[model samples]
Target: MRGVTRSAQGRGELTPMESRILRAAVRLFAEKGFDATTVQEIVDAAEVTKGALYHYFDAKDDLLFEIYHSLISSQMADLDRIIALRLSAADTVRAILVNLVETTASRVDEAAVFTREMHKLNADRMAAFRADRRRYHETFREVIDRAQTAGELGTVVPADTAVLIALGVVNQLPTWYRPDGPKSPQQLGTEIADFVLAALSA
Candidate 1:
């Protein structure tokens, strides 16, 4: 499947100040909730002026959208790359899961904040987010569907159901996953992939 275009398409790389402001916003949004976070608080946390913050992001809503947008954009790129490799269906699925887990784990704060506060985004941004996610979901389901049709995977569960089961765990990572946890993200991802592939084989 083609990579979904980023919401911030045509935006160049973020300057250092922009990165600082985004990091501060993610931290504050995760800690204090989006509505409670003020622009002044983000500036204070980022150690930048209010003007600096506005220079990169128009409002708090922009920060929220950017946080998740960057993540999903990266994931979509990885998905396209994996699909282009022409790997076996199981290998492709494994690579996608591993990449998703590691990336999400690396930016746990961003994921957590976005998951908790994404409802605050403007309608346009929200629609963009949903469309990106739907593309990812449909692409993944197509992979499984083709594999099943070719008899490479069993039909123990429908492709859509399988996608939901796989993604459900990743979506819940923020609530319980810890950076200092016993299992590394890659390890957790492998185990999850093992379970998923096993189910498909059954």
Candidate 2:
């Protein structure tokens, strides 16, 4: 995911109108299923003309794809940055998990909406989505694999299985996590990192 090109809004900077429209779309899509969300409703909520929305996004599907794409793209960039630091395998993995948990928890609405409505993405967007996710998974797995090969991490579980186990918990965050919960994202992320590191070291 290092060299992957981003969407039209490269570098994740969204124009004011784009941001407004996306926020409205995410809220509407979360409240009403994607199938039930209307372009008019989105425009109304965004307080923008239909033409303004069209200028930024080609269709409603684009909005849905962008919702998740922005999140994953930022995560990928963070992963790349973490890898570049060349930290010890334990520290690297901890940083990755902490960033992932914090980002996903911060945007629980985007994650939840995308999880439910991603099937509606067009074929091309769907393929891109899968590719992005695969790249993320493979990159994380490679980190674990390298650590295990160098005896930096215990091989209690295979690298692939370890990646799955680690991400499985993060992926379920949108289901039950609340921003107003007792634990802050940093606290939760640190706890998760500790748990994974303890298991790998054991």
Number of the top-ranking candidate, with lDDT as the measure: 2
lDDT string, candidate 1, 1-202, tens digits: 0112335462324567767888988889878899999999999999998887877777787888888877877788888899999999999989989998998999898999899888988887788789778988998899999999999998999999999999999989989999999999999999999999999999
lDDT of 2 by residue, 65-178 (tens): 888888888899899999999999999999999999999998999999999999998788888889878989999999999999999999999999998988999999999999
Residue clash pairs of candidate 2: none
- Sliding window of 10 residues with minimal summed lDDT for model 1: 1-10
lDDT of candidate model 1 versus the reference? 0.85
TM-score of each: 0.91, 0.93
Off by over 4 Å in 2: 1-10
Q: Please list the Cα RMSD from the true structure of every candidate, rounded to 1 decimal place.
A: 3.4, 2.9
